[model samples]
Target chain A: SQQGEEDPQALSIQEGENATMNCSYKTSINNLQWYRQNSGRGLVHLILIRSNEREKHSGRLRVTLDTSKKSSSLLITASRAADTASYFCAKAGAGSYQLTFGKGTKLSVIP
Target chain B: GAGVSQSPSNKVTEKGKDVELRCDPISGHTALYWYRQSLGQGLEFLIYFQGNSAPDKSGLPSDRFSAERTGGSVSTLTIQRTQQEDSAVYLCASSAWLPSTDTQYFGPGTRLTVL
Candidate 1:
């Protein structure tokens, strides 16, 4: 069973725009990680934020987690066509080693 | 320096035939995992392996599905009497540390099509 759910099944935007996707999980977690997948390819780890932390940034990507709400958001600043891909949020459950993933948000950045 | 790798990027087999998928984790990685992604769906965890400990097979769907890790590095997933519902992208990933802090590195998934 999926432990998390992402909003906006699909998003389309122009180049140089900003893209924001949100995810909400069902159970307590030790950390949350975001991943990107290109067509027919493996996933690429984007970033991870521990439960103790609220926000994290990696290059142009910004992620914010609200444990109180059991939700997280991924923000891509100044997006480009190359940034178009499926974004997924994976939650590592507390005291568990497995990561439960959410239905991803497909982002399409149009040139 | 090589990343996680899976063999036979694509596979097509008849229903009821068995198939074996292989994965080689990054050197020194201690944790390995298998997941399946169907069309337009989220990834479903199939199994997990950590070091020399007993594998966590709780996620496997049925008794026909089984996996084994040899030498604590390479792993194989075998499905006996594959069904059409088993056709999906089988992905392999490995992490150097525990899930609490480790990040999983994925390999190019194997797309299996059962006819």
Candidate 2:
């Protein structure tokens, strides 16, 4: 599928625990990006991994990409209560200008 | 500098009424996009505008949905003869270039409710 469908539609974890979310796409992508939405508002750009790159990190966020499998994962280390939000993976399809988004994974970090 | 901004944070309209949602992208951004999200769903691409190029309107759901970017800065999405099913949050975003190489900045979405 052009859209990157995320797995484990919902995730519940302790505040100090690490959270991992997975996304798989069928089409080849130029790049994949992870975004976080708080209170269902605007999405904040997290990390982007290009087709040529395997991994990227930003603060407590770690993202890994596997071009061969058309899958990507986002890992948030020591997630806090504030980190409770919906995470989405968007694919910038090859040669296309717009992004195709997936039904996101709702993450709830319990205090 | 300021981030992308949307107007009328919330809207409620009758079934036959039309509503227009506005978006002002960050200054100097050359590309803008419009998306819709129903309750608990992902963003749905609606339309895209690039500098001086024809807009991509393939994702629009019906003839009643239309959008236009004026002077390549502000955009307006109009929905006519609104149905209850049309209730959703409409989001706007902008980027310096294509998302393949740039990050898209999003605005606080406009939540529309049609009765």
Q: TM-score of the A chain in candidate 2?
A: 0.96
Model 2 earns a TM-score of: 0.98
The collision pairs in model 2 are none
lDDT of 1 by residue, B1-115 (tens): 9999998899999999999999999999999999999988889999999999999998899999999999999999999999999999999999996777889999999999999
lDDT tens digits, residue span A3-110, model 2: 889988999999999999999998899999999999888999998889999999999999999999999999999999999999999999776788999999999999
State TM-scores per candidate: 0.98, 0.98
Candidates in order: C-alpha RMSD to true structure: 0.9, 0.8
**Candidate 1 overall lDDT versus native:** 0.93
- The residue-by-residue lDDT of candidate 1 on A1-111, one tens digit each, is 577788888999999999999999988999999999999569999999999999999999999999999999999999999999999999997667788898899999999
Model 2 residue runs over 4 Å out of place are none
Give the TM-score of chain A in candidate 1: 0.97
User: Model 1: runs farther than 4 Å from truth?
Assistant: none
DockQ of each: 0.78, 0.83
